[model samples]
Target chain A: MLYALMIYAEPGLDERIPQEEREGVTAEYQALLDDPRVVQAARLHPAEAATCVRVVDGRTLVSDGPFADTKEILGGLALFEADDLDEALEMAARIPAARMGGAVEVRPVVVQP
Target chain B: MLASLVGYLRDFDAAEEATQEAFTIAAERWETSGIPANPGAWLVTTARNRAIDRIRRDRTLTRKIPLLPEPEATMDEFDDPVIDTVIDHLGDTGIKDERLELIFTCCHPALPLEGQVALTLRALGGLSTADIARAFLVSEETMKRRLTRAKAKIKATGIPFAVPQADRLEQRLDAVLAVVYLIYNEGYRGRVDLGAEAIRLGQLLAVLMPEEPESRGLLALMLLHHARRRARFDGEDLVLLGDQDRTLWDLPQLEAGRAALEEAIARGGRGAYVVQAAIADLQTRDEIDWPQVAALYRRLVELTGSPVVELNRAAAVAETGDPAAALEVVDSLDLDGYLYYHSTRGELLRRLGRDDEAAAAYRRALDLATTTPERRFLTGRLEKL
Candidate 1:
């Protein structure tokens, strides 16, 4: 089955990490991406950089920030190929953001034939 | 039967439909042909055939066909064979392990705790969705949606229907045991028979995982508490354990609970459940061992770090003729919102000849109390003060 590990953390959290410990955190994430089960991985720009668009009465309403103002923003996402939800969760727990002041939401991807 | 069928079908909906169809057929056929010698085997064989036929008819279910065992065996071929052949092929030990698999899958940590409890009661306890809804005090539609969403997630997420591997077994089993205990506690507080349902689940778990002492310990704990259910109240008033009529207790069930606790001890079980079960057993004795009970509660507090256990330990300490120390322990705990904390503190204060303090504590307990019996008991204590 395919699962999406949606990583959520405070925006600019990477910038807050100590310079000495930053490389170790990056290495941990790199190790996770190296796993054969990880099909795709990407870290997003800060929520401040996001542009939100909404359709209001067929007129496009453009906004200057992420869709919702929240403490935690979408920090990263990983597409993983796992046998089951448990396997996907095992992969999610390895995400650096999950151990930090963040969370990972594991959702099953709908596979279209 | 549904458990084995689920193992065969690999789909909860399909297995449920197959089981229903099998029973409907049995109801009609049994009236004319008389009941079969082994009705369970007959139902299982019939359900498997129905499931196979249904899977064959539905094109979308073709993906699951590969997962089915003996896909080549046509429905006609299975008509007359001793139904036991299929059960034997499925590996029938004393108790089928498929139920354990079903339970583990239902109680999988990936699922929400509420879903796990409802699913465990539905799948393993053989409870109807309506009965589960009533027991949990939810609308039937809400419960139906809950079950539907849970089953859908299981299918979409590929939650496997098998016992957890050795590495994850302990944690997963604990989740399963916690769900059963939660059900038992809910039943204990309410008028519903969820307690019996929980005990039934505990018994099944104990049998399925004989090596896991916690399972037996949980069963023992529930049985011991359930044995005293009859004397727990006296006409809308809560009755303390010491004041309860002993004859009202279920003696045979209490004996069985003791036997289970001994088995757990023999297996070197020192987990939280085992320790709690040991404490419950000691409390039931005619000559109550207050010191031993306090010691067990201390161990429990270490194991769980729960203020409720500390409060219980304080209560036990007071019974050992040390009200002042027990009062100190109770005061240290941050349990102002807990009714039992206030009640226990009231009792300790009354014993120490602080009538005004005791009355205030009793009033606080009465304010926090939700049930009529609890409020009445607190009122009585205040009156005495």
Candidate 2:
């Protein structure tokens, strides 16, 4: 099964980390992406830089920030190929953001044949 | 049969619908043709076929086509040789493993606790949705939605239909045992015969995981409680264990319970369930050992770190000819809102000849009591004071 591990974190959460621990945190995330099960991974730009776009009737509606105003914002995402949700969850739990005042949503990806 | 179907289909809702369809067909055809020699295998084969047909027709389930077993060359109805071949393919042991897998999947910790309980009862206990709803004091529609949402989450989250690996097995098994115990407690409170259903599930677990002594312990614990079910009450009034009629107890069931507890002990099991079973077994002895019971309660308090267990320990301490110390221990704990705490306090105070305080404590217990018999007992205590 394919799962999308969407990492949600408070804005500027990385900034709060001690300078000495920053490299270790980065290394942890790097280790996660290095896993063979990780099909694709990407760290997103801060939610503030995100542009939301929607086509309404005949006009296009654009927003300056994320689509939802929430305390936690989408920080990163990884697509994983795992046997089941439990395996995907194990990877999700390893995401540094998950233990650092953030959450990882383990969503099963829809398979298309 | 449903378990095997779920194993083959890998979709709970699809398997349930297919099983239902197969049973309906069997009910109509069995009357004229008489029952099949192997009714269970027949139902499983029919359900697998129905599920495969439904999945084939549904375009969105195209990805699941690969998971289905190879179809028979000819999909003829009631082909005895084909059924025999399929049954042979799924040996008897395979069916048993499938049921175990189904149980582990149903009671997975990833699911909500209520979902675990509901799904276990529905799938393993073979309770209808309506019956489960009634037992849980919910409307049929609410129960339906709960089951639907749970099943959907199981599919969407890709919860595997297999026993957890050794690393995760202990924690997962604890969740399963807790759900069964919760069902038994619900029935113990006089909801329905969910206690019987839980015992059946416990028996299945003990058989499936013979090496796991906790399974035997849980089976023992439930059987011990169930053996005393008839002696638990006299008409509508709650009969205290000491006052319960000995003849009303199921002696054979108690023996079975004791034997299960012995097996658990022989396996060197001292987990929460096993300890609890030992405590229960001690309680049923001809001569009660208050000091030993208190020691077990103390151990249980350490193991559970629960205030409720501490309260029980206090009760046992009182039985050891130290009501004053027991009362002091009860007062130290923050259980003012608990009915049993007040009742225990009242009893201790009455023993210490503090009638006025005991009456006040009884009033508090009376206010907190929810059951008729409990209220009556509290009132009687107050009257005596």
Candidate 3:
């Protein structure tokens, strides 16, 4: 089963991260992608740039910004194909995105019949 | 030795900088001279001599005379003739700092009780913010803020480093004892570098209030409790008091406890710590001193009027004579938020052969436990019952 792992990064971490440190983090992300079970992964821009897209009765509506504003923001996400939630969560935990004051939210993805 | 020595002679910030500078110099020079026989002693002597050189070269002391308090009698400044004196002064005993004055300063009751204990642990106990947070069972951010507020209050109030005066000292005695007791407890836990820090705190308080009953009581409490620490746990987990090996108890610590108890007895007025220590001493005795332990508990009840004291008294009272009497006392206590009281009361019930009631109490304790270890331990006891 594939799980969508959401990365929550503490505020202003991107600006604080040096170029060299950023490259190291990117390399870590690349290593995760190399694992065949990782079907999809992307480091999102700051939540402010996000446009929430939802489809109701085949009518798609786009919102101006992200879902919430808090002390932290949803910075990135990944999709992992694993046999169980625990296995998916293990992969999510090792993701560089989840380290350095970030938490990963693991949600199992459902496929349409 | 140099880092610690500099840290002592000068203030924290300056001493740290001087140590760094000395290390940098040593690193550069060592390629030629090779390593010294004793790196620490050589570093200390070099740092001191270097510090003196800088001081004489600066020639700024005369200018700052109005601002800087006159320094301590400079006991033989480091020169070829005075090297022996300097080394003696810098020896382990001289600079151990004891942290006595600092503990008293931090534990002043002008700060709230929580602040007094927390600040003393932070400043003198050498506890990190996260470590304090864990010990207090509070969030790290909350602990950081509390520490910051306490430090700001110190800076704003300009609280003198010297111990408080006569009337206030007597007024604040309880607070001091509480801080010392907490330090001792942390040391007894054996995690955290509390040995040097907390022992130093205890030794400091014991010296500061040589005649105070509770102070001696606090020392006796620590020595007695620490005596069992080696035997308290088996491998990673609590061995439970009934299961602990009596042979492993430290005879030296027990002797020290007896000496402290004598001092506390000689001094007369007592508090809860004295009572607790007396009970622990009784428990460790070859023959239980039931009557004395019960009397101390009764005195503690009079001092604090706390139901917790009544609960403890119940245990000693039962051990002395009637389990029935002890059960009644334990049954009367209303410790709604406390988990241990219920568990303890249950154990007392079991000893008196009230199996069903003991099982119920164990269940209640299991439900109330906050940690996985405590929950597991209580549940295991409940299952067996």
For this target, which candidate reaches the highest DockQ against the unseen true structure? 2
Residue-pair clashes per candidate: 0, 0, 0
Off by over 4 Å in 2: A6-38, A43-76, A90-105, A110-113, B1-103, B112-152, B165-167
Docking model 1 quality class: acceptable
Q: Which candidate number would show the highest lDDT if scored against the true structure?
A: 1
- Mark the 10 consecutive residues where model 1 chain A has the least summed lDDT: A104-113
The complex in candidate 2 yields a DockQ of: 0.42
Return the TM-score for candidate 1, rounded to 2 decimals. Answer: 0.60
Q: Evaluate candidate 1 by giving its C-alpha RMSD to the native, one decimal.
A: 15.3
For candidate 2, give the lDDT of residue A11. 97
- Per-residue CA lDDT of model 2 for B1-385, tens digit only, reads 7788788888999999999999999999999999999999999888888888888788656667766774542221212242234334434553443456767887887788778888776665556777678767688777776776666678668898788877777778888998788778767766437788788778988886788999899999999998998888777677777888989999999999999999999998898899889988988898889899899999998899989899999998998899999998899999888888999999999999999999999999999887797898889889987
Best by TM-score: 2
- Give the per-residue lDDT digits (tens) of candidate 2, residues A1-113: 99999999999977888987888999998888899999999999998799999999989999899988999999989999999877887778889999999999888887655
The residue pairs in collision within model 1 are none
Predictions in order: lDDT: 0.84, 0.83, 0.71
DockQ (0 to 1) for model 3: 0.01
**DockQ score of the complex predicted as candidate 1:** 0.34
Model 1, position B58: C-alpha lDDT score: 81
Model 2, position A4: C-alpha lDDT score: 92
lDDT for residue B96 in candidate 1, whole number 0-100: 50
If you score just chain A, what TM-score does every candidate get?
0.95, 0.97, 0.78
